[model samples]
Target: MNAAVLTALIALVSSVVGGAIVAAVNHHYSVKEDLHARRLDLSVDRLSEAYMFMLLNLTIDKDKHREYQIHLANIQLFGSPTTVSLTNNLMRRQAGEPVDVTTGALLSDILNSIRNDLGLDRIDTADLVRLNLGDEVDLLKRESSK
Candidate 1:
């Protein structure tokens, strides 16, 4: 019957359209997810570089002082607001301009920003100490076994 053939044709066309819609939606989501993942990776790398520079600065290595500035600049470009704020707080303290923020609080803020970037729950300073201690204990056990 022509009616049956017409019905089948309509069904086929509808299915094709639906499939195309689904494929387009899927591709869009996949690209979006990949972009998001890349951004997070970039953020992590920038923040880590900044932290390394901060550590290097602690040694008072004049040669690395310029490197420290470059690293911090990279962080400023890609890092979240919290990361920038922590760097600003430390820079102020380093300049010896009498920061209202305590050294302890500044350090804690840096750690918290790092944790947040890593998608971790915010932890108190005591928890950070405990985390370090746990790793130390693992090292101790390994040493004792050796």
Candidate 2:
């Protein structure tokens, strides 16, 4: 082939190869990022659900305080908040978000106190406190489900 035709063929081949590489990289990274985002979303959803359940339980009979405490403990073990692990900016973004760490901890404390004052043995004050104020929320429900 003439020089111009050979040069054109090389350019076309290079363009196709470059496009494929770019697409592959983007697809691979995007899928990984998407998985991470979905995981975070799921975590947030579960945390919110736990908070709602606790709120609903509180609206029940005060005589069921022990049961409610157990439920709170279960939420603690299950919906443990992990938002604290997020950066300050992300946490700030959650400023308007309900079921925050402070609030969750307070709820746990009140439940533990009511349970203890009622002479309940199935519950632990420190565990309740830790579960409430502890580190990032864990996938406690998944662990318990097994």
Model 2 alpha-carbon miss at residue 34, Å: 2.0
Candidate 2 TM-score, C-alpha based: 0.43
- Per-model TM-score, in order, reads 0.70, 0.43
Tell how far residue 75 is off in model 1, in angstroms: 2.5
Per-residue error for 142 in candidate 2, Å, reads: 31
- Residues 1-146, model 1: lDDT tens digits: 69999999999999999999999999999999999999878877776766655533444478777887787677677666765676676678779867554434444555566778788998865333222333554322232234
lDDT for model 1 comes to 0.65
Which candidate should be chosen as best, given lDDT against the real structure? 1
**Candidate 2 ranges with C-alpha deviation above 4 Å:** 58-146
Question: Positional deviation of 17 in candidate 2, in angstroms?
Answer: 0.5
Candidate 2: C-alpha lDDT: 0.49
How displaced is residue 100 in candidate 1, in Å?
Answer: 3.0
